[model samples]
Target: MCSSCVMLFNEKNGSILPEYTDLPTLQKGEILVKNKYTTLCGSDLHTFTGRRKEPSPIVLGHEIVGEILELAQNEPFYDLNGNILKAGDLITWTIFAATESDEFVKDKMPQKSASLFKYGHVQFTEKEKFNGGLGTHCVLKRGTGILKVPLSVDEKFAPIINCAGATAMAAHRLIDEIENKNVLILGAGVLGLIASAIAKQKKAATVTILDIDDTRLENSKSFGADNVYNSLNPIEELTAITSKFYKKGFDIVIDMSGSVEAIKTGLKFSATGAQHIWIGAVTPTENIEINPEVMIRKLLSIKGMHNYNYEDFINAVNFFEDHFTDYPFGTFIEKEFPLQETEKAFQYAIKHKPYRVLITI
Candidate 1:
């Protein structure tokens, strides 16, 4: 029997106090993983500051890497490589744990469908309390797509694969291909930075990023952004500067900032037969007006993506395996906080605007 466990409980008013709960007994189709690293993402910040509504007193976090603690016997479960999973293996799973088969899952878009049981976005009940990466141990229920991580991938950089890396990979699917295309990215956050690097690796001719944070913009340089611009400038000035690369607009536009103004300005620069991907508006904000005529004239296609599917997660792991050693991916983790100091870590990340503040379990 498992004993009492500790987790960084989200108290909303900027507190991640350590809370204790009894661990649930493992059952068929259930697996338990000891937490290694849990990422504090932009969504966590929104929930921390009360901008996003969530169940109070819940354990909050989803981006995670953990070691297999226990697994159900006789359960038909396979890792990404079709290898049978066993205890002591390092692994991560998709954020969405589908409760039932549905059309969406059949269509390969399980991120937001089919009786979702989202890690870190759920409230704990008496039956089973821990549900997120902030916990000492997290439950990976049935239907979760578990993937094995090779020893080559550092634990620090692997957690973001569930969120940042896969999300970018999903967004990249918006365009037919990235090679030789001129790409524009808005926001120098984790997703934008990774997508930029991935696009560059795919041979994008010119990769430009627009963001207000100079520090983050500078950080994008190492990640594959060919050019960085301050979006704080007037829309026309931003347009003119971006236009110098391609007079009309880029072949592909990716918006990770979710700013209405930025979207409006970015739309103007998309070339004929272009693809625009919107991913960063994870939170609802003020809506902006746009001219549909541009879509009509340029034959532009806009795609909006949320959390990624399982295949993207697998691809993310491959991307890390190929590039983790070469790029400064691990450097994004600026500081680490113990499980109990999650509140402090969130505050530090907010104040310093570091690439990411991690919860090291």
Candidate 2:
């Protein structure tokens, strides 16, 4: 049995309570982790605003990093040559334990059917036991998919790997296939900064980051962006920067802002044969207008990316180990708090801070 438990619930509007609950026993292929820290994300803000509907009493905060305590006896999934995994390995896994069945992630072929959620839903699973990272400790189940992280990596940096860092790295990996590309990133938030850093590290000729927030723009420069634009009209800023830098549209455009307007603006700046990768989760209710003629004329390819695969997570971790401090990971952090003050921590992340907010357990 666990000593303490905290459950997030929306019994009243904008009110969250961490109620004590029973901690269940761990089963095979599962490991109990003492929650070290979890970071607040933009999605958590959407939840607070009631923009995204969620079932009450649901565990919250998906961006998590913790210490391993206990592990299940079972092991599965091999390497490229089929070797079984063992315990005592520090790793990270996506928040998917309930949907690991054959019906969940199996991408059906011939007819070509994709699963409902590629990483199979960020929802909590009994098998994985900690719904979101809001609680003290979570049980990550094996076969639920986990990636080994370096023990030397700081816990504060771990959560970033699971979500924003992984996504940016994955997008950059995809865009890296094309040679001598100039990339434009829309937004200077944590995701945008991470993406820009990865893009520059991967040899992109130039990286331009756009955001209306001047503070964030300055923050972007610290992360290796060749150019930063703070403007209400990102299109104009992008055009001017491109004219001065590349004198043409960018070879790749990555939109991390997820704003419908940002998507439209990015489309205006996409070069011929350029590819656009969407890492942000745009509002489902919003519709983005696009000209098919422009797409065809520019021969542009637009793709939507979700959570990271194992490779992406590894790359992000490596990136952190090598350059996290040099890029001012410390500068990006706004504040930190203890786990007991999860409410206040989250509120700060939601209402005020943009770069990062962390909770130490």
In model 2, pairs of residues that clash are none
TM-score for model 2? 0.85
Per-model C-alpha lDDT, please? 0.82, 0.68
lDDT of 1 at 238: 56
lDDT of 2 at 345: 78
Let me know the TM-score candidate 1 reaches against the reference structure: 0.94
Q: Report the lDDT tens digits of candidate 1 across residue range 204-229.
A: 98899989988888889998888888
Q: Which residue pairs in candidate 1 have backbone atoms (N, alpha carbon, C) closer than 3 angstroms, thus clashing?
A: 249-269
lDDT of 2: 0.68
Q: Provide TM-scores for the models.
A: 0.94, 0.85
Task: Estimate, for each residue in 260-352, the C-alpha lDDT of model 2 and write its tens digit.
Answer: 777777787777888999888545747777788988888989887776555666577778878776677655557888767877876787778
| lDDT computed for candidate 1 | 0.82
